[model samples]
Target chain A: MDDRSFVAAQDFLLSSKTFWTKQIYEDLKRTYEDAVARSGKTPTTPADVAAILEGDTLYRYFAWLERHLQRLKYAGRYGLVPYHDERRSVLAPPLRDTGAELSPTLEMPSYYRRVDIHQHPGGVMSDELDGYVYERGARSTTPLMGASHADLHHRFTDLVAAQDAERVLYGRILDMGCGFGKSTQPFHEAYPDARIDAIDLSGPCLALAAHQAPSRSSPKVRFRQMNACATDYEPDSFDLVTSTMLVHELPPGEIEKLFAEAARILAPGGRMVHLDFHAIDGPFARFMHYGHGLRNNEPFMQPWAEMDIHASLSDKGFTNIKVIPFQEAEGVDLENHAAWRFPWTVIQAELKTGG
Target chain B: MRISDSLILDRPEQNFFADPALDRAFGVVMALATEVYVQRDRVRALERKLEAAGIIDRADMDREPSEDERQANAEDREAFVEGLMINLLGKQQAKGAS
Candidate 1:
């Protein structure tokens, strides 16, 4: 479908809430019941039921439900509030000098900690299910991922064409929180010489990523289970490090640690790019973001948006920090074309000279 | 539970459109409801298994749902669907603005 029709479809889906409540929700409930019955256990609580179907396939199904729900929801509330509420006390800027000390005891909150919920069955986050959920969700929405792939390829190709862009050619590349390897695989194709490693805390997701990576025939990229804040890799090891839609999932303190980790892992002159949401210049857009975070249980999204990430990276001894607003579908500048697109952005930074 | 009593599932702070927490809650509920529905069927199928295993008394296991209980369950489902619709509408509004 063309862009306009895709946007229309998205709008229709988002606006019709009752239909989904009756149909989709019921179907999901039925499917989950069927799956659990097959598993041979009767769960007394919701948590127990989740535990029963806690795998990639189940996660994909959950993701499918989530995306449809999100799509329906997104259509109705476009540009309502600040996507990030920086003024809120919970989202107040982090203390600058938290230091290089990594707390071994630091653990995520119980609700936020577990790998299973984060990578819900049949959802985009469940990498173990290949790109089934991710690809299908994107297709159902508006060809955003398909467009993103084309955009990334174009962007990398353009960057490669530029003079003095030799670094894009080779070196170890790390994709932090590389769910199902969508972002990671493209880099491998773009820079065939680079040794790529994708990391996440979910084993199922990594398993899916590993399984899917081979089809691209891009040197069989390595997928590892590792926290974004702490990694087993040596310092200054990677020439390029990237993450997509990950930072918003982390609280402000964790984001600081992530920057530190990226700083530690990147070689001199290496760059880091994170694809995520941004603060739109308008109040309506900003309000939408704030509401989105609060309603969506993206606990850290507001804080992450309000964060002076450029300054944070600077403090982490990084230079040339920039948050570039790109199209969710095209990854192109929205201001340039006024294409009705998702409000996604990318923040790119480089280690400063003589840092 | 009284069949006449109305059950209301209210998510006061929940934003139907953009809140992932609500979305996750919805997902969990969907999964739970699905699991429960499936379990009911499984119990019917496993009557022999339960009798052989002696998890339930074979004679008592045949008890049917009471009229009141069935009415209460139907009410609960209706309430759940209603709340879900409201949440879904809120979400749709949020999505449209984006």
Candidate 2:
């Protein structure tokens, strides 16, 4: 497809997604409330809500749109996957000379191999230009996040930069699962003097990450292919360890290991901050989010939410742990916003230095 | 084989809708959504053509769109979604008046 048609198709998907989020979601929420009232049960769990409303027409339509809209976004006639496939030559490059390490032989964990993880044709790891594909597909990930998408990353960086200066200071950072460097870009920009080592399981994504980086950046990010669960780095290697939107892609067990690895690598008095989806607004939202996991091929989102990061962090002997709702936009994160949105939250914990 | 034809059926989300009518209706709505934006783009392109032909001045092109223009755009979108919603969901339910 020509550029005009391709962009038009993506814009259509974005508008359709906005309609689903703004209009259809409200209708579905009402249907859930009515169904729960009929069943005489105010749902306390997502399962309870699902049991009550999953069979309703509105809920089913919501589910169908939730699934197919994403598929349509990535795999439809002018979808990102095929579009990027055609532009593979434009996107593919040699990572070896770029100073980024590529592991051609790392055994992809079974959990990563099992699911497509975002309705992408192949998950982010498979195709050579899949990183470029992900970067494009991300443009429409949340329709509400249209032009202000860049601002969300900047807002998150502001939150991290606002960390209490007296508590923990950082000179070196590790960004886990930094796909295509989108999550890592702002950090490099914000703390240009601080060294950043970004690792992802996908070589394709790391290659793109390095390619996208500005060549002369001070403390330029070193992109490496490595599993977040078990990195080769020694303990106390990083003053700050972080990941964004990655924990939800992992099973609870892997998430546990990831936390252990981050904690192990974090210097004493160092912090770990992650921006991820959590803080589901209500029971209806919970029902939809869990069902979204089922429909979108992300098997672990609901389970990750259920894992309770605060408890896990506390168990690892971390101090000052907090899971707070992140304001992605000025007013959108408030509870009263009628549109459907990811329950963005910041989970932060600090390793303590004790006498 | 076309890349689009490759199997997406591994997950239940691929083809879970049981009713053919609803499924086809979804396809129609999505296609319509795509065309709606396409038309808007065409309109903008024509406006740009007018500016190129010196019909609409460069200053006018540089200026922000009027409130009237913004309202018209919003109304067009509202009408389109309202009609499309009514098509997918019958008028009674789609009206959604409390």
Candidate 3:
């Protein structure tokens, strides 16, 4: 198609009411109803009703809405006719301060604790639903699958490559909270010599991920259920430990425990890389990000973003701790020369040998 | 509207003149809005009918719906089809002279 025709086609796809009513809207409603029915209860409260709507379904629906909003916002800037609600609900209130709270007894706000649409048996972070939601959300945001998928895959690989490059051997790589194996598959593919173990707390998502991975013929990628904060793995077992978009879902205490676990599992010279959001420097940038967390039902995101991740890593006895801005499309940029990409960073730390 | 000899209306042209992305976004938004409006109207109508039938107390039923309850009922499939016409017609007008 010519440029004009292509643009026209794109416009039609975006604005066409029939497209949504006949396809996405209908399909989503059907899926929601089926899921609710499968759960076998008519919930009286919004929270209970939300629980019945599988996390994947909620994730997919929100993913769809988010993309639409992105397009609308993009279009609005150029006066191309804005589409979505410019004024929507803001993010929820910050967690009540419980100073010096050392335990994992921190109670998540009701909104944050509510079950996601993906029916993520627990919540967004711990289950296979995370993988499904992330994959579906990522794919929905970008339709051209090959390059987008490859870019993310390669970025993940580079993270692994940075750790075990000298030896040319990756003994075992553990991907904690390996949602749908999107971040996990790359480790296996990057180091074919290594065994990749993906862990999460959600059984349904794990089952789905297991089924999806082999169908795509990924090698040596295994999915299992285990909390990231407390895994059953032996100490110093994994040569490399990694997690993607996992840490933010956890509260402060859980996050500390997770780092401790990663530190425990890493052999000498072994590295821990966690792909997540970082506190963007400056006040205005910080405000925009915190606002995003509140409006998106991401209760812990703001706290996670504000926490000194580098300090956390260091406190856990990990050396060479650094919060490097990670360009998801292009791996870690040591020189830091990219512009106009989503704000994301990876916390890269190495477990100190003995003391 | 009289029924003529059975005619298939060429699957009403799917293309919207707007940007494909915009079309998709608007389509979903409009559909959702329409769905919400229709559902709201249906529930109101049902409540009215129930009141007329003496099934529910009119004064209690006449109270404005809670936002959360409205959201649930609006998206509820059981209450949706009854509300379809309002959304479909409303969307046509919102689409402009296309």
What is each candidate's DockQ, to 2 decimals?
0.03, 0.22, 0.02
| TM-score versus the correct structure, for each prediction | 0.53, 0.83, 0.52
Q: Candidate 1, what DockQ? A: 0.03
* Candidate 2 off by > 4 Å: A35-40, A94-97, A165-168, B1-21, B28-98
- Return whichever of 2 and 3 wins on DockQ: 2
| Interface RMSD, candidates in the order listed | 18.2, 3.5, 17.9
Winning model by TM-score = 2
Task: Give lDDT per model, in order.
Answer: 0.55, 0.81, 0.55
Q: Please report, as a residue range, the 10-residue window in candidate 3 chain A with the lowest summed lDDT.
A: A83-92
Ranked by TM-score, top first: 2, 1, 3
User: Per-residue error at A160 for model 3, in Å?
Assistant: 3.2
Candidate 1 residues A1-355, lDDT tens each?
A: 1223334434444333334434544554566568667978666543564454434353444344544355332221220011111122322222112121223344434434432222223232322232333433333333234344546534643443242366453478888987656667667766667788888765544555665565235554677667888888898788778887788888788889989999998888887888777746553335435544644456666678788987899898898888877544434556642322335777888886566
| lDDT for each residue of candidate 3 in B1-98, tens digit (9 for 90 to 100) | 11122211232222222335654665467445533544555577678888889899968756898898787887576566757657766444455665
Give the poorly placed runs of model 3, Cα more than 4 Å off.
A1-134, A141-150, A166-169, A215-219, A330-341, B1-29, B32-98
Q: Give the best candidate by DockQ.
A: 2
